[model samples]
Target: LWGIPLLHTEGDERTDVILGKFLKARDFKVSQALAMLKNCVLWRKSFKADEILDEELGADFDGMAFMFGEDKEGHPVCYNVFGVLQDKDLYSKVFGDDAARFLRWRVQLQEKGVKMLKLEPSTPNALLQVIDLKNAPWPAKKVRSVLLKAISLLQDNYPELVIKNVFINVPWYYSAVFSLLSPFLTQHQKNKFVVTRLGKSTEALFKLISPEKVPIQYGGLGRAGDDEFSGADAPVTELPIKAGEKKTVELAVTTGGSSITWDLVVVGSEVSYGAEFQPDQEGGYTTIIEKTKKISAQLEEPIRNSFKASEPGKVVLSIDNSLSKKKKSVVYRHIVKAA
Candidate 1:
C-alpha cells in the first residue's frame, strides 16, 4: 500500500521512524535505508517539492511527502505519496489508465498558458508508451533501452519525474518536446529539461521553442554614448539616412580654454562612416571631413578641446554614399575657433 508523504524534512523524527520500521520489516540494512532517506531529503529541499506542487496544483496543504513503503515481510516496494485531489476522477485519469488523462491535461494546460509538468518515471508504462507515440524519435529498441534507464533513475528519485531521456541525444527534438510540454510542467520540473547543444544552433533552438520567454537582454542593439550626449545639449547632432541613402551632419568641438582631442563615431542600423582631417594655415586649427556610405543616424565626434585656435575658423566634414550603386556623397562642416 502507498504511504509516502508528498514532502519530508531532515529533522522529521516520524519520517526517520517510518524509514527505520520499513527497513526493519524488510530485513534490509537500516544504514542503507538511512542513506536513501538522506538522499530523499536533499532532493526534496533542492526541488522545493512542497512549494512547487502547491503553486502548480493551486492547493493549500501542510506539505507533500514521499516514502518507499514496504510489505509485512520488509521487501523494497513501489512508491506512494499522500495528497488530496479536488477532482478524484481527474486525478485517476491523469495518473491512472496509461496516463491518457495526463497527456490530455498537458495539452489542456498548454492551451491555458501553463508551461510545465512533472510525473514519476514509473508512471504506468502505458503512459510512457503514449508519450513515446507522440514524441519518440528513436527506434523501438533504442526507446526501450533509454526508457528503462530513465525509469530506473526515476525510481531511485521516487516521486520526482525522470527527464534524462529527453536529453540523452537529439537535443533539438528534446527541446521541441519539452517546449510542447512546457505548458503542462511545473517551473521546477521544467528546469530539469536541459538543451545540450551549443553555439548558434542552441540559440536558434531556444528562440524557436520559447521566443516569448527568452530574456530581453539577449536581443536588441545597444545605444551609443554619443546619442546620449547629443540629446543632452552637446554641440553635436546626428544625421538620418535611409537604406542606401546618405546624409552629413556638422559637429562643434568647443576648446573651452584647453586643447582637446575628439573622435567621430557613426551610429546606424547598417551603415559605415569615415573621416579625414585638414589643418589650417596657422597650424593652430584643423578641419575634420566625415563620410557615410548609406543613410542612417549616428553620433559622430566626441569633442575634446585642444590648442585654442584664438580666432574664429571653420572645420569641414563630409559623408559619401558608399553603399549606393550610383555613388553619391554628403558633407558636414563644423567651426570651432575661439568661443
Candidate 2:
C-alpha cells in the first residue's frame, strides 16, 4: 500500500517479513493483524505519507529535522532539534490540529532513511535518530501528546526500524518528562536509547558515527551550512507561483562530484517537477530527472530528488504549474555537499 517494493530482512530468508511487522504489531493474531494492517494502510493512504518527500512543512520548521550521515553500521543518522519545536507554537503553525500531518512528516523521514539503507545492502535494517532536548519549551502534556502519536506509528508500522535513539543535551529537569515516556518504550528499545549532555565529552556520539561523518555542529567534519540543524537556524526559501508559470532554483556546485539535494511541495492538486545539471565545462545541459503527476486535491505531498555532479557546475530545480489554473505556493529545502 505504501508503494515500496517488498524488501528482505537480510539473514532472515522469510519472504513475509514485511508482513511480519503488522502481525507483530497485532500480537501475531491473524484477524487482528488484518484489521490493524488495513487501518494502517488506510491511515497512510489518507495522510499521503509517500508524498511529503523532504519539503518544509512550515516556514519556521524547515530544517528543524534532517539526515546527516550514517552510523558505524551504515544506518542513516537523523537529527531532530527538539529545542526548536515549541509544541504549541510550532505544531500549531505547521499542522493546525491535523495530527496525521504531523505524524506523516515523521514517517516520511523514516522512509527516507530506509531508502538510504537500500544503497548499502550490507547494512542492517535500522536507522539512528538523535533528538536534542536542550531547551525545549513545550509543557509535559503537549510533549506527551506528540510522543503518543509517534509511538503508535513507529511501534506499529515501522517496528525494529530504529536501532538507536540518542537524546542529546537534555536539560536537568528532563527526567520528569522522560518518566512519562518510559512506560511506552519496550525494554529492548530502552536498551538502545541514550540521553546525554556533551559536557566536553562527545565520546558517545563518536562511538556511533565517525567524526568525519558527524556534522561540524557536533564537533565533526560533516557540513550543514546555514541549516537549522546546524544550530544556525538558517532561513529557507518559499516560492509563490501562478498557473502556467515556472520557477528555477539553482545551487552552485564548485567541487567535482558534489551532491545537490532538493525538496519541494505543491500545496495544491498537481504540478510538473524536473531537475537538470548544468556542467561548468562548456557542455550542454543534462536532464537528470523529469517527473510530473496530478495528485488529487488532497495534497501532492513533497517531491525530493538529488544527483551528484561529475564536475563543478550548477544544479537547477524547475517546477511547472502550467496544467493547473490556480495560484500555488511551494516551500523548498535545499542541501549541497561534495560527497
Candidate 3:
C-alpha cells in the first residue's frame, strides 16, 4: 500500500486533517506512507513533510509508491510507481555468470516464439535475486571476439543450432563493426540480430531476404516522363484515333523552331511502312492516307481488327529526323496477343 499528501492553494495542513485520521484508522501502514514519501523525493527531489501527506495519500492502498507536489508554476501533480517481486533462485539459473547457460536459455525462449526481452535498470536487484546474474566487465574492448568464441562452441556442440548476438542501444561507433560481422552470421543469426535504431537510414544497410525481393521493369530512351526527351528534337504531340480503330494509316508531322524534315516508319515482318515530310519553322505538315485510296482493303481490314480477334501480332511505330540524319526517334511496340 502507498500514500501521498495532497495540497490546496493555501498550502494549509488543516484542509484535510479529519480525512487523514479516518485514513490512518483504516489500517494504512506508516511504513507504506514513508515509502510514498521516498518515491516523491526520487521524482521531485524536495517536498514539505506536511504538504507531502496532504497531496499524495488515498484511502485504498496497494503495495506501491506515490508522489505529491506542484510544479514551479503551482500546478498540482501526483503519481504512483508500482513494484512486483519475483523468485530469486530462478534468476541465477537464467542470467548468471556463465555466458553458456544464458545463451542456452535465450535460445530456448526464442524457440518458444518470444519476440522481445526487456530489462529494467531499476529492477536489476529484483532480477538478480532470482538468478545468479552478473554483468560482463565494463569497458571491454574485444566483446565481439568473446562472443564469437561462445558462438563457435555452441555450433560445434549443438550442430543443429546457431547463435547470434543482438545488442540493443548500440552506440554509433560500433555500427561499422556490426557490418563487418554480418556476412559470417547465419540465417537464424540474421533473423535474431535486428538493429532497432536503423530508422530512415536502414534502407542503405539492410539486405533483402528472399521473400522480400521484387523484380523491376526497365524502360528505354524517349519514354514518357523522361527528361532526355525534351527540346525541339522531341516536341510534345498526340496521336488520336477512333475508339474501335486498331490503327491509323495516316501520319502528321509538327515542329517548332527551325525548319526540319522527319521520317515516320512502321516496322513489322508482314507489313513495313515509311514516309518523309519537311515542315517550315513553326509550321507542320499532314500526310493523309485517304484510307479508301492509299491502303488496300485487305491490309486496312487487318489494321482495323480488334485485339479480341487478333490472337498474335507485333507492330512497331517509329519517328525520326532526316535533316541531321539522326535516329532521334520514339519507338514503341505492341503485342496484340499473349505469348
Candidate 4:
C-alpha cells in the first residue's frame, strides 16, 4: 500500500502499520481493512502506479508536481497544480483520455513525497500538501472529472499518506465540490484539511506552519518553484546574487518592433528589477522599465513584461539587489519574437 514493490505483510513492520491503520479506519474490522488493502493492491497494479516512479512512466509529469521543504510537523511538503491548471483540453490531450496514467501521476507525486520523507532523521508516515487554487475557475467537464478522480483515489486507497491538506485560496465554488469530495474522505481525513478562504490568511497558516517553511509569495520564508514559464526552445536560467549585486540578460532583437517577453523571480528577498532597450544606432540604452516593486521572497509570481524594440538592438533585463542584505536567486526566462 505504501508503493513497496512487494509488501511483506508477513512480519514487515510497515505492512503491519498499514493494516493497523486500515483496521482503525474501518472500525477495527479486519475483513473491511483487508478488503481495502487488497483493492488497493489490485488498483495499483491496474493503474501502473508501481511503475510511476520508473523513468519512462513518470517523465511527462516530472515538474507538474514537485516536492520541496517540510511542514512544521516535519512532514514533507508537496505542492500540486490542481489549483492553477491553465489548459485542461491541452492537458487532457498531453496525457490522453487514460485516467490510469493521470492517476499514476497522483500516486507518483505522493510516492515522491514518501521518498523525500525517508530523507528525514525519522521517516514521517504522512506528507503535507498545499493545493493552490489561484486563478482556478470551474473548468470543463474533463477538468472536473480529473479532480474528482484524483481526490477519490487518494482518499480511498491512500490512507493517511497526507497528514494535512492545506487548501490555499480555495474558491467558493469549491465548497460544493468539497461536499462531493467529503463522502470520499474519512472523518480522520476530513479533520486534517485546512481550508483558507482568503489567500492572504497568513496568520492561520502560520499557526500550523512556521514562517521559514512557508513560501515568501505565500507570506512565508520558504522558497519554492512558482509560476515560471519557459518554452522548449527558451529555457530558464538561474542566477545567484548577493546584496548590492546586479545582473543583466541580453536578448537579441534582430528586427525593429521585435518583442521581448520576460519572466523573472527573485528568491529570499525582493530586489529592484527592470528592463532596458539599447538601439543599434548611437541611440544608447533607454530604460524601458526601471522600477522596484515588492515581490515574494519564497516563491515568485512571475513578473512578466513584453516590450517591443524600437529598432534592431539589444534588450537587457536587469536585476538589482542593492536594497536587501540577503542574497537571492533569480529564475528567469525570456523570448524575443519578431513583430
Candidate 5:
C-alpha cells in the first residue's frame, strides 16, 4: 500500500511496519486494527485507489488541492484551496451531479502525497495539510456532504497519514459548525486540527512552517516563478514591529560592486515601507532606494526589490506600523549578489 510492498513475501519487516501503522491508528487494539486493515484493503480493491494515480483527472481539479513544499520536520505539505470551488461553473463541473469523480481525484492527490513518504516506522510518513477556506462554500449542502464523505474515507482508510490539518482563513460560522461536530470527533482527531481566523494565516503558518517554504499568497517570503531566490537560499528572518512604532532591518554591504535583493511582507495590516542605503565612510551620503509607500492590508504578495551599490554601506528597510494599534510581524529575506 502506498508503494510499500504489502505482500507477506516482500519482507517481514515491511509487513510489520504496515501492521504497525494500522495498530497505531487503532490505539494498539489488535482486533480493531486488523478489522480496519481488512476494510482498507477491500476498499482499495473496490475503489481502484491504486490505479487512480494512473488516471488523469485533468486541470479542472488542479486548483482544488496540490502538494507543495515540506514542513519543519520534512513532512510534505499539501494545500487545499477551498475558495476555488466558489466558481459555480467549475464547481458544477467537478462536484456536480455526483461527487464520485471529485472523490477519486482527491484520493489521487492523497496517493501522490503518500508516494513522497517513506512509510517506515521511523521516518516522518504523514502529510501536513493547509486548507484555505477563504470564500469557500462552507455552508453549502453539497460542499458539506462531499467533504464529510471525503474526511470519513481518509480517516478510515488512510489512517494517520496526515500529521497536522491546519485550517486557515476560517469563517466565523465554522466555529458553530465545529461545535456541532466536535462531539463526534475523537480526541486524537481533534488534536491534529489547527484553526486560524482570517488575517492570521501567515502568523499561524509560520509557527508550523518556515516562511520560505510557505507561499506568498499566505503572507510568506516565498513567491512563484522566483529566479532570484530559491528554497535552498538564505534563511528567512522575522522581525516584530511594535504597535505605533517603526523598525528598521539593516543588511550591511561590506564590499562595493554588489547588488542587494530582498523580499519582505508585513502581516495582518497596512504599513508604510521604504528602503535606503547609508555609506560607511564618514560624512558619506545616504541614498534613497524606494520612497515610503503604504502597503495595503489586501496585498497578496510580498514586496521584492533590489539595489546596486558602488560603495560600502548598509541597506536599511523600514516598516512603520504607527497607524495601527496591533503589533505586527514581518517576514523577510535578503541576498547579496556580486555585480
Candidate 6:
C-alpha cells in the first residue's frame, strides 16, 4: 500500500513483503489477507491517505505524538503522549462529538511513522509505538471512543507496521480498560502490547531503548538543549549499586590540556552524588567538581557536567545509595577531548 505493488505476479521482494504483512496480521490466511488488502486499498483512496501528509494538522497536536530515536533493532520509535488531552480545550477539540479530524491527524502521524520503516524483506519494517498515558483523561467516554476508533483504523489498515505498543505510566485502573480492549484485539496484537505503571516506565523503557536514545524525562541520559554529546557519542555504561553501598566511576586524564564531559542518571530513587578531580602527581591536590549533594527522587533530568584538566588527573564520579533500601541502576557516558 505504501508505493509497493501487492499483486503476487509482481515477483518482487517489496511486493512480497507488503503481502506478507497482511498475511501475518491475519494468521497467514490467504483469503482474509487478500480481503484486507482490497479493503485497505479502497479505504486509502476514499480517505485520501496518500494526501494526508501534505495537510497541515496544526501545532496543537505537535506534542501529542512524535518520532524519536530508534530502538535496539533500529526500528524508529513513535511516542504518543495522551497526557496532552488533559487540557480541557484540547480534550474538547480532539474528542468532541466529531472525531474525524482527530482520526485524520492520528492517522497522519501513523503515516509519518510508517515512512520511517524500510519495508524490505530483511530490514526492520516496523516502528516501536510508545504511548504515554500519564495524566490522560481515561474516564472520559468521548475520549475512549475516539481512541478505540483510531486504534481500530490503524490496526486494520496498517497491519504489521508496529513492533510493539508500549503503554507507559499507566494508572491502576488501566487493567479494566485493557480487558475491554482485549475483545477487539487478536492474540498476535495482545502479545505485542507492553504496559508499565507509574514511576517504572523509565526502567521498562531502558530495556527496549538505549540510554542515550531515551529522553531524560523518562530517566535516561538523552537531553534536548545544549547537550554536550550527540547521538554519535560513546555508548553508556551501567553500574549497579546495592542497598547501603557506594560506587565510583573514574575517568583517567592521561595527558594535560584535556576536557572531560559526562552524563549520569540514577534510576528509581534518590542518591548522594559527587564528582572530583584527583591528580596523579605525588602529593597533588584533589579538586571537587560537584559538591556531595543529595539528589532528590523527584529529579527527572539526568546529570551532565564537564571539567578541564590542566594536568594529569582522573575525574571520579561517586554515587551513594546507603540511605535507600532498594538497589539502584546507574547509566552514564563520558567523553574526553584533547586540547
On lDDT, the leading prediction is 6
lDDT of 2 by residue, 237-267 (tens): 5577798887787777899878777655544
Query: In model 1, what is the error at residue 215, expressed in angstroms?
Result: 15
How large an RMSD does model 3 have?
A: 26.9
List candidate 2 segments past 4 Å from native.
1-17, 20-38, 54-59, 86-100, 119-122, 198-201, 225-339
| Tens-digit lDDT string for candidate 6 (1-339) | 877776667776888788889999999999999899899999999999999999987777777888878888999998898889888788888888436887888899899888887788899999999999898776556656877888889989999999999999999777777987899999999999999988888889988999888887778776666456765457789898899999899999889999999888888788899999999998999999999998753576888888999999999999999888999878898998899
TM-score of each: 0.24, 0.55, 0.19, 0.60, 0.93, 0.96
Winner on TM-score between 5 and 6 is 6
Quantify all predictions' global Cα lDDT against the true fold.
0.33, 0.65, 0.28, 0.67, 0.84, 0.87
Residue-level error in angstroms, candidate 6, position 315: 0.5
Summed over model 6, clashes come to: 0
Q: In model 2, which range of ten residues has the least summed lDDT?
A: 293-302
lDDT: worst 10-residue window of model 6: 224-233
Collision count for each candidate, in order: 36, 2, 19, 1, 0, 0
Residues 273-309 of candidate 5 have per-residue lDDT tens digits of 9999999998999999999999954687888888899
Candidate 1 local distance difference test against the native: 0.33
Report residue 106 deviation for candidate 6 (angstroms): 1.1
Model 1, 1-339: lDDT tens digits are 013342355443334334543354224666765666567667546644334423444222211111122222222112111122234553343344634323332322222211121122322111110011222232334333433443333333342222222231232444544444456444655454444332222133222222212112211121223232232322323344445665544343334432223333333223555444333336764544434233332223222223343333333345544464442222221323334
Query: For candidate 3, what is the TM-score?
Result: 0.19
Better of 4 and 5 by TM-score: 5
- Which residues of candidate 5, in runs, are more than 4 Å off? 7-9, 12-14, 231-233
Better of 2 and 4 by lDDT: 4
Clashes of 1: 36
